[model samples]
Target: MRWRDTDKSSNIEDRRDQQMASAGVPSALLMRLLPFLLRTKIGRIVLLLGGAYLAFQYFTGGYSLEPSNTSGFSQSQSASNGQLQDENAQFVAAILGTTETVWNQLLKGRYVDPKLVLYRNMTSTGCGMGQAQSGPFYCPADSKVYIDLSFLEELKKLGAPGDFAFAYVIAHEVGHHVQNLLGTNAKVRQAQQATDKVGANQLSVGLELQADCYAGVWGHYVDKQLNLLEAGDVDEGIAAASAVGDDRLQKMAGRAVQPEAFTHGSSAQRIKWFKVGFASGDIASCNTFTAK
Candidate 1:
């Protein structure tokens, strides 16, 4: 949590000002109208006409069906970017820098630091449109991590607050980057393809748990080598890991706890794995795939 004085990372891509344009028709509305439109001849004719008009516009460069922004970057958002840089953005860069330092040393020249993107609302990513509602994520396709600062507020609402908690979230995404670097993600995807739904979910759980462990490993170095952890910092990290557990999230959403549907494991599983890595500070000991 003592990251204010740390160096900011140069790998940050700030896209907070580049807001996503609105789509003409919300996808949900289009889905709702689709069945009715397909059921009648007149409606079918209307659909055909609409499609033809859109295609013609596309070919003629008359209009675009894609989301469009009249003004590129809104003035308010551009101004807000300055405010973010003063604290939030700097904190992110510092945390990322620490991760880069730790992982680069841990991997011994094999680690390729992934770019971290700062965005607001939504943004285009290598994996597709990244949305804040989905929280932070690492896109292996692009070898980058995307985060919306708003998610920090969401984390606080989930009962995990403080700088170290946010650091843990960042570290977890970086852990995913490490998985991608080591080809663990690809192997997991291949295995998932060969399995049933429940089996696939189990694989996903293992993958997520491993990331949590990796985060703990990063914490280990940050605490032991850098001496950044303060009193109650570890608790903040644990609370964060627990807050986002699939089971806890499901319960919070008023849904029944279903381990079979869990992709990120339960609260206990996450805390246990994180502790496992922290206790050993060894990647070999962090493997969740073969663990009972």
Candidate 2:
């Protein structure tokens, strides 16, 4: 968690100043029926089916998409915003530099590095239109990671605080990029397409947990090689993992922790897998696919 006294990464694009909005089928399109997805049992089933159908439709040209490669991915941000933009940009850049260092070393001669994009409100990505509300996520379509710093405020409210928590957030998203490079994400996507709602959610949970494990592995690199731990940094990471667990989110949303509804793994599972990765620093240790 001791990330200071160094230079910032050039790969980050800070757009924290933009006055942007969503370009998707606006909330108005599903406002009335949206609550049902989080409410009724049948609603969740319908929601998953609708998502699958739409994905199929889009795969068949329901929406025109531009095929763009991110081999030389670059960051773009508006400088016309606020001080928070600069502050968060530096914070994110430093963490990304740390990840790049670890992954570059771990992958040795093989892995391809990914770019991280920092934006406010909303932005267009190779995967699709990304918004701040979804938290931080990696778009495999573009091989770029997107983040909204506002999520930090929400994190503190969820009982997860400190620099390591934010670092873990970035690491988890970057873990998706790692998955992309390793082809785990593509396999998951294929399974998601072929499976039913309940089974698919199980696969999604495995994928998310594996990302958590990868994030933990990143921490191992920083802690062992970079000497970055400052006492309670690991605790901060665990707190964040707990805060964002499916059970905790379900409770916060006033719903039951339905096993079939879980896409991300439970609090204990996330923490356990992350610890495994941190302890081993070996990708082979992250076989959440085979773990019970």
The candidate that achieves the highest TM-score relative to the unseen native structure:
1
Q: After TM-score superposition, what is the CA distance of residue 249 in candidate 2 from its true location, in Å?
A: 0.4
Please identify model 2 stretches exceeding 4 Å from their true place.
21-85
lDDT value, residue 144 of candidate 1: 89
| lDDT tens per residue, model 1, 1-292 | 7887776777777676564323355544655797999999998998898778755764577633232354333322322323445588888988998999899999997999888888777676778668888999999999989999999999999999999999999999999999999999999999999999999999999999999999999999999998889999999999999999999999999999999999999999999988888887888887899999
Per-residue lDDT over 104-141 for candidate 2, one digit per residue giving the tens place of the 0 to 100 score: 88888867878777766566688776888889889999
Q: Once superposed on the true structure, which residue ranges of model 1 sit more than 4 Å away at CA?
A: 22-84
TM-scores for every predicted model: 0.82, 0.79
How many clashes in candidate 1? Answer: 0
**Model 1 Cα displacement at 251 (Å)?**
0.8
lDDT (C-alpha) at residue 108 in model 1: 94
20 in model 2: Cα distance from truth in Å?
Answer: 3.5
For model 1, the run of ten residues with the poorest summed lDDT: 72-81
C-alpha lDDT values of all predictions: 0.85, 0.80
RMSD of each: 5.4, 6.9
